[model samples]
Target: MRELTTAETVREKGSWLFTVRDQYGELDEVILVPCDNESGSASGQASTDGGVEAWINRCTHEAQRFDTGRGVPMREGRIICPKHGSMFDSCSGYCDNGEAADTTLPSVDISVRNDGRIVLTDDELTFVGEGGIDDNESDGDDGPASTSHIGF
Candidate 1:
């Protein structure tokens, strides 16, 4: 199993993004969204086990990405689709409403370790790195690069 990130980091950020390659050699990404605790509260408890769930980052209806390299919009244990209004349960990934009604998001297997380290346990997917693939990565420069914010 390849370690993705710490559970604490996912808990803090509400989600963590990582790149992966499947058995067919297709590159994709996974989003680890934080799940609610037993009391229905999404916060206030810190542990090394079982507070995050991994989804394929695509909606079941239109294949629209839930995260889109940004944070997922969540509401009370449900992951909201940005394109439509479908909501999937954070724990089960079942969508009970909207265009994705009665469908479930395909989940990627993940394990939260005793040491607070989150690892990808799915044999079909290999961990590449953190964050989604940058679409702008190429060998050629389009033009003279301008000094932008964040020191590019």
Candidate 2:
């Protein structure tokens, strides 16, 4: 597990942007939004009171970075994608409007330690960057083909 930031830090800002290297050795950014404190849940979920939730900083529709420039706008416990005015459920990362309708934001698993530190879980550590592999290209072997999938 990778230590992201202190829990207190996230509680103060309500949200934080974390940049980390994926298993592929490429840079990937995740946005951590704090859930309501009254709920006592550390996992990503929207709350009015303020736990931490993590999601890929990119929009699922057009692959646009949600954290670019001024960052995404938060209203009524949701993050609005500036590119297309899509509102994603902050905790679940579900989008129900705009071009991103029915699609959900990729979530990053995380845990808050007793020491008040936020850590990224192992299963959510791998991410493949855009065009990392070509779908039309092959290994050039006609025999039994091998397949492998990488994702966070």
Candidate 3:
């Protein structure tokens, strides 16, 4: 288990982002959002554990990013997909009323430590670093030769 950040830090924002390398060794981004409070029905009502939950950053409908390197837009314990406005419950990750209805966000395992820090506990993922995967890094090859010949 690798400590990602304190639960309090996630609760303070509408959403949190982190990076991890999956079993395939490809970097992926995950998101953390505030779950419902004690009764577990209302969102962002912080408790001792901070009501934190984790999920893959992509929305199921269009694979749109939930965090996109910034905080996600949320309401009442739900994560709203900015593309089509599908709302997913932060706790259950289920979208019941939109293009994503009947689909659930892919879950990422996580746990809080005694010290109040949240950690990535998924067996198939290794902690990479903070924030989303940096697309700037690339292979030595110049990718595809630019077709437009309006060269520099």
* lDDT of candidates 1 onward, in order: 0.79, 0.67, 0.80
The residue pairs found clashing in candidate 1 are none
Off by over 4 Å in 3: 37-49, 135-152
Tens digit per residue, CA lDDT, model 2, 61-99: 888777663445677777788788898877677889999
lDDT tens digits, residues 27-101, model 3? Answer: 888998877556542223344455788899999988999887668989887899989999998887888999999
Model 3 vs. true fold: TM: 0.81
**Candidate 1 per-residue C-alpha lDDT over 91-145 given as tens digits, one digit per residue, 9 for 90 to 100:** 6778899999989788888888888898899999988778885542334877557
lDDT of 3: 0.80
* Superposition error at 10 for model 1 (Å): 1.1
Instruction: For candidate 2, list the clashing residue pairs, or say none.
Output: 35-50, 35-51, 36-50, 37-49, 37-50
Off by over 4 Å in 2: 37-50, 69-71, 123-152
Lowest-scoring 10 consecutive residues by lDDT in candidate 2? 127-136
**Candidate 3: 10-residue stretch with minimal lDDT:** 39-48
TM-scores for all predictions: 0.80, 0.67, 0.81
